[model samples]
Target: MDFAFLFIDWLGKPLWMWLAFISIVIALLVFDLGILHRDNREIEVRESLALSSMYIGLGLAFGVWVWWQLGPESGMNYLTGFVVEKTLALDNVFVIALIFSFFAVPRKYQHRVLFWGILGVIVLRAIMIGLGTTLVSQFSWVLYIFAAFLVITGIKMLWIGDKEPEIGNNPLINFMRRRFNVTDEHHGQDFFVKKPHPATGKLVWFMTPLFMALVMVEIADVIFAVDSVPAIFAITTDPFIVYTSNIFAILGLRALYFALAAMIHRFKYLKPALAIVLIFIGSKIFIADLLGLEKFPAALSLGVTFAIIASGVIWSLIKTRGSQEAHSNGG
Candidate 1:
C-alpha cells in the first residue's frame, strides 16, 4: 500500500480510454511514416521544412484539444512544458552531431537512426514522467529532491557546462567494445546489423547503426533530463502534461535534428540560458516552503522562462555576429 502510494498515481483513469488513445496515436504514426512515407529514401530540405511545419501544427492541434477538454490552465501548462522541453532538447542535438562526427556517421542514414531513437525517448520519458508525477503528488517532498538536484546541476553548469565537449573515449563504451566483436567497417542500411564468419560458421562480428547512436542518444537524453525533468515541475506537477509535452517535443526531434544540425553551435549562449533555467526553477522550489508560496502558478513561470530564453538567444546571435565580423577583419 505504501509502495503504491509512493510510486503510482492513485488518480484513476479509464482502461479502455487509455488503450484507445495510445492506439490512435500509434496508428497515426504508422500511417504517416510507414504507409505514406515508406517510398522516400532520404528526407530532403523541403521535406524537412514541411515536416517541421506539420510537427508544429500537430502540437498546436494537441494544445487546442487540451483547451477544449480540460480548460485554459491545462493548455497553458502544455505550452510551457513544450517550450522549455523543446529548447533544452536542442542541446542534445549538438552532442549527437559531435558524436556522429566522432564516429564518422555518414549523412544519409543519420535521420533513420535518430528517428527511431527519438521515438524510444518519447516512450521512455512517458513512463518516467508518469512515475515522477505520482511521486510528487503523493509525497510532495520529491519536489525538494528535484530542487536540490537542479541547484547542484545549475552550479555545475555555470561552472563548466560551457566547456567544449570531449568525445574521445568513454570508459563504458570502451568496455563494450572490448566485450563485443565490433565490425571494422560500418554495415549500412541497418540498425541491427549483424554478420556471420566463414571460418567459425557463426556470428563473428555485429552492430547496428543504432548501436553507437543509441548510446549517445541515451547519454544526451539523461543529461537533458537532469534539467528538463525538474524544470517541468515549475510548469505543473501533473505527470500527464509533462509526458504529453515531452512526447510532442521529442516527436519533432528527428526533423529538428536535420534542420538545426549545421547551426546549433552558433547559439553560443544556450548553455547560459539553460543554466539560468535550472537555477530559477531550483530557487522556485526552495522558496515554496520558506515563503509559503505553494500557490505559485505555472502560467507566470512559463511567461518568465520564455522571456529569459528569448533574451539569451538574441544575445548569442549578436555576439556570434560580432565575433565573425572581428575575425573577417583579421582582428
Candidate 2:
C-alpha cells in the first residue's frame, strides 16, 4: 500500500491526521473498557477522579499534537473548544445525575449507561457537525445566526438562573412507559430482560430502567449539542478541529461526571461565566467588523474564555464556602 495516499488531504487535513485521531480514540476506549474497567463495577469518587485525570491529560496532549501539526491558530481553537465543551458539559452532568436518580438506577449500573450513552453521542455529534460544516460552507452568513442564538441563550441562562428539568414528567418517558413493558425495578446491569408480558401472558423482553436512563442521557446530549456545537463553530469552522475537540471533551465527560456529581454545588457560579463567554464569542464578529479587522485573535479568545471560567469557579468556591462548611458541620 502506498503511504502517499495517507498523506493526501481530506477536508483540508491530511488523511493520516484523521486516522491518527481515530486510532487514539479507539485505543483510549479499549483501554477504558477492555483493560482498566474489564468488569462492570461501581466507580467511587477517588477512582473516578483518577480516571478523569487520565482522560483530561489525554485531551490536553491531543491539543499539543494538534499544535505541532496544524499550527498555532488551529491549536488555540482546539483548546478553546475543548475548554468550552468540557465546562458546558457540567450542566450535562447535573442532568445525568437526575436521570439516574429518576430511574432509580444504582451506582453500579450508572457507568454502564454512561458508557453506552457516549457511543450514541459519538454518532450523533458526527452527524450534527457534518450538517453544520455543510451549512457553514454553503452559507457563510449562518455564523451570524449561530452568534445571535448563542448570545440569546447566554442571556437566558443568566436571567433564568439554573432550573433543573422535570425529568419525571418527560413526554418521551411517559410514552415509552405506556407503549412498552417496562420493569418497575432494575434487573442488575442489563438494559433488557426476559419477563412475562402483562397482556400476552408469555415470556417477552422487557425494558429496564437502565435503558430509560440511557435514552434520557442520549436525548440530553442532543439538546446540549445545540448550544455546544454552535459555540465551537464560533471559534473555528474547520470540521476536523470542531469534531475532534468535541469528541475529546465528551470522552472525558463520563469520568468528570462522577467527580463533579459528588460536589456540584461548588461550581454554582460557573453558569454565569459560561453565559459571558458565549456573549463575548457572539459579539466578536461585530467587534471585528467595527474595528475593520479581518477576524478576532484566536489566542485572545482562548485567554478571555479561560479567564472568565476561572474567575467564576474561584468566586463560586469563595461565596459557597460558608454554606458548605455549615452543611458539613450539620452533617
Best by lDDT: 2
Model 2: pairs clashing at backbone N, Cα or C within 3 Å:
none
For model 1, the run of ten residues with the poorest summed lDDT: 4-13
The residue ranges of model 2 lying beyond 4 angstroms of the native Cα positions read none
lDDT of 1 by residue, 90-174 (tens): 7788888887887777777777667667777866687677778788878988888888887788788889966867776776567
Local distance difference test, per candidate?
Answer: 0.72, 0.91
Q: What is the lDDT of residue 192 in candidate 2?
A: 93
TM-score of each: 0.85, 0.97
